[model samples]
Target: MGVLESILRKDGRKFMKRKDSDAGEPGRALEELRGSLYSDFHTSDGAKRQQQRLCGPFVAMTFNFIVAVGIIMANKVVMGMVGFNFPIALSLIHYLTSWFLMAIFKALSLLPASPPSKTTPFSSIFLLGAVMALATGLANVSLQHNSVGFYQMAKIAVTPTIVLAEFMLFSKKVSIQKVITLAVVSIGVAVATVTDLEFNVFGACVALAWIVPSAINKILWSNLQQTGNWTALALMWKTSPITIFFFMSLMPLLDPPGVLSFNWNSNNLFAIVISALFGFLLQWSGALALGATSATSHVVLGQFKTCVIMLGGYIFFNSDPGIVSLSGAVVALCGMSFYTYLNLLGSKESATTSNKLLSKQNSFSQKPKTAEDDVKVEVNTLSSV
Candidate 1:
């Protein structure tokens, strides 16, 4: 009986050890998996950052395209087809709505709160706001006076204007390839859109006048983003109030005399509200795109948006696109594609250079002690001892 009891106790101990080993096997496997995952994540950090950088421009471009198309369609329906014909008044409503929306976003803490700018004064912000208001208001006026095709042609000018302004004002250098791309895009837009070059002197003047301020506004927005560390929302919030004030002051002067006499209906009211909403979105998206990329890229995106809108017009409004238009669009697309490829190549090269630098830095920081270092350490230790 004593031998049997001892044997049972030994068996029990063996079973407990077996159970402990089983548990530890899973824990060791889990630890190995965790280590593998951590190593992968650490190694891919640079690639992840590159992907994020690429995604910024992509997201910004998409937002700009969608909001721009919506605004263009809404504006056409409201001002041209519906005969609301009050561009400045519409702009005023847009600014007001934008300010209200920005305020709501801030109140809800949906956007990060940016402290007031130390480098950029409030006066500079207000001036930028005024320029933006003027540029957009004049653009609307130009659209009212010009045909859709002509308006799009005028828009094509903006890219070159911005590029030229950057070169002249900031001494910024654009690659020859990019410059050629811009030229191709401009020519394509002109061929695709300009069917009948209807020259309204007033419209021409307004379009030309807006170009300078529009260019300046884009550059200023980019600068402010870098210098002020401002997000799209924060910049818009700061500028919206001044824009609203400017629009209010200009509306009375610039709106057509018949604006007050227009018949009020549910359709008009709905269109106005929708237009205002789209306008707000346009401003927000445009700011985001400009903040994410350069002014030149923003202008290129505008050209792309024009191409899409032209296609949309053909499909939805039965606006016949000629063979020339189709060919021009293809050319424009090719140019944009080539430009994108160049940008990607540039980005990859930059990332590779950065990685090389980082590796060198790490090697330098983690370098092993030399023989001289060891000798000095031994001498110091011996003296202390």
Candidate 2:
């Protein structure tokens, strides 16, 4: 509450009293005052649940874009001032160093939580982190073989993999609309890949690897989010150490062991900060959202990431968002929107049915949580090549 706004407690009820000033209309002023809380301050149950439903995947999709775009721009920025001489070594080093910083931040956040039980198994998180690292490495390798289309298709498949993984690992259900959204996004990705129709078998194989761990991580993280209650930073950091381990283990497996060199350049630091800033903001917004409700709903809703970037690239990068790409974005986004709407309806209906069940005094107590408990997991940085 600002000082100029009068505050009063009458009959033990608090009310805001705003004085007339240059504050424009009272409604606008009131909305401005409540700006920070607008997303979560809804008084209606329906609205609150709706946000809960859309929060997870939305954040996940947004995070994916931020990380990808940041890295692309950062690489371009570094090359303009520096050069590719540093790419082979510095890129890898920057990635490792950023992992260390992320881990430090995550550790700081977990300080107040009751110490992680010594017996709690972390093997799954470790293995999943390694999967992400390998998948990312494959993505890096694919960059050398094919055009941008290949990259988009390979990554877009992650959404469907997530849906399937959820069902296999946690018995999650998907509506027809979500299935449609998944297919549309897949088409966008595949069509994007067709930009390089001459992709070789090896390149295609490398590209396909991008989706495997991506989907796996999503499922693992969704489970973790539901049960872990850890901040995104902490979860990321906690799993991050495993990536280092994965890298170390890979050193000897190559023809000539690849070493992760130290590159403590200014550009490296800049990329790290940008990555962390985006990570902090995007994840925090998502956490607030998931606290309210379906991780799956959020993912399906977030495919618009490709659409926004496609438009921006067309405008600034001189590459046209071709009729095909634009149509793909539209089709994909529309399908995702329908998926989101139907999922919300299903959740609300399920909640209502459960409410009725409670009122009936049935033999069995009503089970809570209308939707599957979901976890959202992701790893992206702005420093990768």
Candidate 3:
């Protein structure tokens, strides 16, 4: 009987051990699944951050292209078909609309927080806005006085002008490779767009005059956003009033008389308002692109936009731009693509160089200071002074 009881107890102990082991198997499986899920979540989050960084410039350029093309087409309909001949007045309306939108966005908390307005002086914002307005007004005047081909030529010249202006104003040096690529882009655009060659002293003067302000405007827009940490909406909000003031100041000089006599049909009003909305978008998107990329890149993007517009016109409007023009457009596209690739490569190299510099600095900082090193530092500081 004693042996039987001991055997039963041993079997019971074995049964209990087997049951505990069976329960732990499912527990271990669940823990493994949980760990894997957590790891995947973190990996996905990292991937998303990297994707956003990679897509930042791409998204900005895409927005700029779509809005810019839409605005140009819409303005044609409003000004030519709808007969809203007052370009300056239209510009004023655009400024007002943009300002209104900014206010709404601010109220809705849609725009990201930017540095305080006080950080960027009122004068600087005012100057930027004034230049922006002047650039617009001068462009209109140039277009009015010059042939379309001459106007496009002047527009193409803006790339080099901006490069030269940056070098002169900021001591920024562009690579020779980039310069050559830009030259090709300009020639291609010229070949593609310039058909009629008309020259008037007044037109030539206006076109030349238009270049400086345009360059300054682009540079300031880029600098303020990139360096000042200004959000595009915030900057646009601050500048819109100054822009509106300039448009009002210039309307008398630039806009033809009898604006009030134009037929005020609902269709015309709607078209103009739509164009104004697009104009606001154009301002925002241009600022975004400028902020994301350099001023020169923005100008190149504008040239790309021009090619796309011409092709689109040919496709949608059934207007023939000739095989030569199409070929030029193809060439321009290729040049622009090459320019983008070079820029990306340059950026990677610069980043690597900067990282190396930062590592050297850190290592030097981490090193124990010696009397000799301290003496050398003091001597260098005194020499700098």
Worst 10 residues of 2 by lDDT: 373-382
Clash tally, candidates in order: 0, 11, 0
Model 2, position 177: C-alpha lDDT score: 62
Ranking by lDDT: 3, 1, 2
Model 3 misplaced stretches (Cα beyond 4 Å): 1-55, 199-201, 315-318, 358-385
Give the clashing pairs for model 3. none
Worst 10 residues of 1 by lDDT: 42-51
Question: How much lDDT does candidate 3 score?
Answer: 0.86
- The residue pairs in collision within model 1 are none
Q: What is the C-alpha lDDT profile of model 3 across 5-100, one tens digit per residue?
A: 999999999999999899989999999987765443234333223323544788989998999889988999997999887878888888899999
Superposed Cα deviation of residue 127, candidate 3 (Å) = 1.2
1 or 2, which is superior by TM-score? 1
